[model samples]
Target: MTAQRDMKEKNPWHMSGMVALAVIGVIALVTLVAVMVIQNMPLAQKYKYGIVLDAGSSHTTVFIYEWPAEKDNNTGRAEQKHSCDVKGPGISSYVGTPWKAGQTLRECMRQAEDNIPEKRRAETPLYLGATAGMRLLHMKNSSASEEVFRAVSDTLQTFPFSYQGARILSGQEEGAYGWVTVNYLDNRLKQGLRTTGALDLGGASTQISFVPQALDGGGSPGNSVTFRLYGNDYNLYTHSFLCYGKDQALRMALAHHTQSGPMAIKDPCFHPGYAATKAYSDLYDSPCVSDRKPQGAPESFLHTGIGNFQQCQDVVRTLFNFSQCKYSRCSFNGVYQPPLQGHFGAFSAYYYTMSFFNLTDTSIPLDTVKETIARFCATPWQQVKQENPGTKLKYLVEYCFAGAYLITLLTDGYNFTAETYADIKFIHKIKGSDAGWTLGYMLNLTNMIPAEAPDTPPLPYSGYVTIVTVTVFLLLALLLLVGRTFRPSCFKRSLII
Candidate 1:
């Protein structure tokens, strides 16, 4: 009997042993199921793409953006994948020869085709948003603008992407979207953090947008734009000044100095020793200065430079009309603007011009910034060229004027004081995306940014897996303990015998 009892205990199929085996089988099953679930879950990421063509005043840029296929409505998911600058000027430049504008986009569109995956190409939405340049063209010649649009539309339709219509973005939209781009990339919208202002200085226009502490009831209602994003409401103050862009502003300044129709005039904005013959017709071609053309003006005039920063600022300030304001307050030209608020991101030409002079760092005192620009402006034209070898002559010569104009625009036109000037950060890009309206424009059109926060899993995939694995092991240990403690009656009786 003793030998039989010992044999039963030694038998692996005895009740306790059987129970332990069962527990192990359960563990194996649970582990296998867990792994299968995890593996079957969408472990690999797939992406969707979007294409936005930023048709600006100076040039056109193609921006390709991508986001996770499943998380389109999530914040910060969309990012700039690739960008191509369409060679030549903006489409508005092809007023008479509109077909050439369409041709200009072909190379860039082909590049877009190469960058986006074939699978995603068909579904990818393509959009073209023209800014100030087109607006000006439309005002000057509506028929020519329409033709340009039609031509651009025809060219875009040829691509496999889902071509959305091309149209001009209003100044308000331009300013607001630029604000969105800056704040979105900063992740401020998602987290419900304080927002940053956006200052976009384009070739044909400039935009200022920000959220003020309070909206004055007496302020101009036209300047206000409200949006509900991520369960938060934002009241934005945005304005785009027409004919206030760097290039346009330059024309205005030159127009101011050449009112007498002189054969030669010395411009304070340009570096000393600079001389260029500019046609009166070319200068007066734009609607900004067309009315100001001197009657019976010479065909061309000799333009010379004196390199005076203070005088250049005085010249630039003449363009702004601070004389009248129907509203509670004004920035310039009687345009209503609330008190400046929060940090500001200066982009596009603001970044480019400041980057050229190494004045992008806002930490540098306002006086120091002025001193630096003054020094550059005072530099002789030949010396400037020699210092920047291989640089385009047209752009290089204009930097002094551009620099003086920027400082004056900020301080005099926008009313940014020396203390407040430090709040401005000259940024061309934030994270990987360009700090412009294109991404924001895309996000708005696609509904990629949800009005409310998106639902998310309680734990990350890895954390959940670890917890599940640990829980399974713990359950198995408890099951084994129970199995050992409560043996079957038959087994107990056998042991007793």
Candidate 2:
């Protein structure tokens, strides 16, 4: 009995050990269940998505891309690509009365939902980002502006899943993001030819970006690009000069003329090259008396013929150089300082330069050029809508212009310029109305495959990303340091493995 009692005492800790084991088992089971629940949730439901509602000076585009899907640990399948759409009128320069931009978005979403399967329709996420239109809406007296934005936000909140925020992407970021999406999807501009530059021309603004290739060493060179965007992503370390668009430039020129007391002399320093000058001349230069009558003349003289590729090149160079021009006015005195250039010439100069100067010398076969322009010009909305379903054709064309410009600028070794001028044949073939992905056309134009540039280094001045990162990091660090005083247990809890 004594020996039995001693044995029982020796095994006394067994109960405590069993209790500990049970507690640990329950904890592990709960953790596994929680993870399973999270994993099973659809990506749109679990992850936050962003919306870039670009309300331009003349138009608006609401771009919503499904957030990159996360790889599921348990199932081992990648998340699926998701898409959403919404739109509003360009409110950037709107005046007089507020329009139904918000209602337009609601209508667009409703249309999109109508097209989706009922089951899948409820699974998707949505967001709205307003741009120039909103900025101009608030302008000097923002009381009304704030109210409009608040109204937009409130209306957006009515949806099951939606976010409404001001989208003030910097010029550089706008260019960079566009480029990133292009290259990420198409893989253009790889290795030595990876250096890229872009110019986006709009009614009220122009934007440019320069992306350099990766060096043999894995670091990016400190090069900068200048373009247009309002002051949204200033932190992205870009230069956005406002009132520098073509119309703005023209307006500026006229304004400067008025400011300089009339009959201002032309400054030869800041001159547009042949193509750009011609474009400007076509628009503003007086017609020759020898060519046509004063009032009833054909408008052809007023319209600059579509610029050839070489003409575009010359214009681009002129524009870039013109920005540095020092105008000297021939004042009654020997000469006065020439007035500064404005957005009209400057803005046009940028597009001409980007399209011509930056591109490789591949002659777009005259046939191809004619066909492309004709098809593009004649492409009906119904056909495109039937094929691409919900995309805007104008946006795709603009994207193509940017892509073509980038490809030409970067791939100089291709002898495309010389060949283009001499023997390249243009073919106008529209394969289908569904060709909404402009990358395909752009890639074929340059004979580049989209898989070539998977890991190329991004440009140095990627707009607000750098600033946003630093700000977020600083805020996180401060929170950590301060929170330790009030909730030291929080820190200890975080440290627990």
Candidate 3:
């Protein structure tokens, strides 16, 4: 009995010894779990930055964007942090003195420099994309355009940010990027949602882009662009009409009106009190008006406002040639387009004119817009200025004409009927970011647009925690139960043997 008692006592599975073994096992299991938790914890977030400069015809703007480092290709990771509009006209306007183009960018570049952190300044990419104004300038005088590029490039090179090339963006590129911008900002591209069509109106051009319902319905391959984004293929139809923007269109319409001779041109689009004189050379300079320009003898035409919406619509309607089309369907001027699918976003001048004329809200019918334009056109030009104090007088006086032209363009040129008109939403900005092509351009150049979704765990974070917690406890319980059942009497016997 004494030997048996000693044997029992010697065993490590004695009650107190079992309790101690259990405490050690718990500590070891806890240590293992703590190590795994440390391994799974997410690292601290780090952010990176980038910059893009939109040197548009009417104005120039600098856009600064940032994204987190770990999520380089994630949708919505990059967002606009700041944007600065360069003072005075666009870089293309500095044609006569090309060096001044570089000088014009300094103010905005300073703002960009101030906004970016010192460490990131060197790594951030800076890009300048000149649009239609430069395109026209390049067509008219290649040397002047080259000089302008040289000037802007020199200035950009001086900045600490990485300077990507500065040059003209093809109209197709402009339209594609504009489409990408709208869809990206809408979060559609990333989320695999149906995309909105983009209609961008600049000073010298207008572009329409959308993913067609029938991918092959788009008329020509040249007018279409294909992109694989987030594991989905997008076949987009895009076309940019040169000299179709409000500013250039106005120039062409005025030229068409004065073909009768340069005396006291009565323009129905302008308010009754408005009068402006445009030189013949100035009108002739545009490709839209070159053919209609009078024989070398004419000086200038005096334009007087008549303020008639019906007449204005008539004039604007003549600007588009609806008669000619090779495709089963065309928007205008033989440009092929599928029946527009989904909603449309009209930005730039579209938003400006619509907002100024109280047509920004949805459900604004064609007749409703026409009625507003007629009333606003009748308002004396002076009263118009007073209502929109400090507004650029040029744009203010032209609002009546712009409103009429916008209505005519949509109804006649694009065939957006009153029934479907509500789908056309005019927006200048999306989530504080200007709805323009520059952001999308930058996103593409930096490879931020991923072709596939990033790999993610099948289970969610909560599922992981619950699974691990339950699994660890179950495993530890099994080990404890086995230890309790096996009894340490074997250890005491082994010592004797």
Candidate 4:
């Protein structure tokens, strides 16, 4: 009877049953934790895309932007994926042969098609926004502008993407959207940081946009733009001066010098020894200087260079009419302007021209910049060409003029003084995206940037995962400790037997 009782106490089945329960319980707990984690885990990441074509005065650029499919409304989430520069002048140049404008986009469209996934192409939105060049073309010939747009639209529609019709963005729209692009890329809009001003210098126009420290309700109504972005209200002072772009301004300067139809004119803007015969008709073709064209002018004129920086600046200043203003303040040409505020981003031609001169660094004193440009202008044309052999003669010869014009436009026209010059940042791109209006245009059209801030998860994914893992480990350890504490005496006896 004593042996039977001891055997009952030391039953191996009981010990084994207890051990089995602990193991099963641990397995079940682990399985349940894994199931919870697996169910909550994010799936493979997928992306959605948007395309914007920046059809500026000088050229056309196709920008491909993409964002996570699940987080389309998130601020600063959309980034530039790829960009292709169309190989031709802007679509406005194709007015006489509008069909050719459509052809210019083929290669770039093909590149965009290849870059975006086939499945997403159908839903991907594609938009084309023409800037100042088309504005000028539209002003000159509305019929031609319509034809060019029709041709461009027809070509864009042929692509698999969701084609939004091509249209000319207003001067105000151009400036405002450009401001949006700069601020958005910098993550300033969502954070409500002091906004940066935008200065876009294109071929046919220049835009200046900023939020003044003191709101001037008394200024010209046409110059003001208001926006509600990321729950922040912004009253922007923006103006686009037509025919003030570097290229058009250059034309105006040349027109001033050639008033008498002189066959051989000395141009201080060009490098010494530089000479080119240009047609009078070509010079006076644009609306900017067409009225100023001297009657009975010769078929062509012998354009010659004298290379004088002071003279060049003097000539550039003539383009701006500082003679009269009806407002309390004026930038130029009788245009109303409020007081300048905050840091400014000077892009497009501003960046390119300054970059070419190695004067993009605003830290350099204004006087030093002028000195460097003056020295560059004084360099003989032959020596200039020899030093920069790889550069195209067309762009190479114009550096001197562009530099002088840039300085004059900022200081004399926009009233940026020597003390305030450092505030301007000459930038081509910001965080991989070109600093321009296209991204903002797309964002506005697609409603990608929500007016309100997006909701966020209580715990980050990594934090949740770590907590779950730690919890599971702690639970298993506790179970093991309990099993040891409550373990049957039969398990030890069975081992000894």
Candidate 4 Cα errors over 4 Å, as ranges: 1-30, 40-46, 69-76, 217-219, 448-497
- Backbone steric clashes in candidate 4, count: 0
Taking the tens digit of each residue's C-alpha lDDT, what string does model 2 give over 1-497?
A: 55445544565434564465456555645654554455445533323222334455555544333322232211111111322343434654334434454555565455445543455434444434343334434444476555555555565556544343544445444444433233223223222123222334444344433332211211212224332221111111112333333433333333232232322222211212211121222333311111222233233322112323343333323222222222232111121212211111112233333333222223444345433433432344344346554555444323222333322322221112433333221111112111111221222212211121222222233433464455456545545544553364345445552
lDDT winner = 1
**Candidate 3 positional error at 433, Å:** 1.3
Mind giving the per-residue lDDT tens digits that candidate 1 earns over 1-497? 77666767665566776677677778767775776576556544667788999999989999999876554334436789999999999999999899999999999999999999898899888999999999999999999999999999999999999998899999999999999999989998878999999999998999999999977837577788997665678999999999999999999999998898999999899989999899999998898899999988899999999999999898988999989988777899999888899899999999999999888999999999999999999999989999999779879999999999999999998999999999999998889899999988866765743333434455677977787787678767767755675465467666667
Candidates by lDDT, descending order: 1, 4, 3, 2
Report how far off residue 100 is in candidate 4 (Å): 1.7
Rank all candidate structures by their TM-score, best first, as comma-separated numbers.
4, 1, 3, 2
Residues 275-299, model 3: lDDT tens digits: 8876777877866677887665367
Off by over 4 Å in 2: 1-52, 64-68, 71-89, 93-95, 115-125, 132-141, 188-195, 213-239, 253-497
Off by over 4 Å in 1: 1-42, 71-76, 217-219, 448-497
lDDT of 1 at 59: 95
TM-score leader: 4
Q: lDDT of each structure?
A: 0.88, 0.34, 0.82, 0.87
Is candidate 3 or 4 superior in lDDT?
4
Q: Which lDDT value does model 1 have at 205?
A: 94
- For TM-score, candidate 1 versus 2, the one ahead is 1
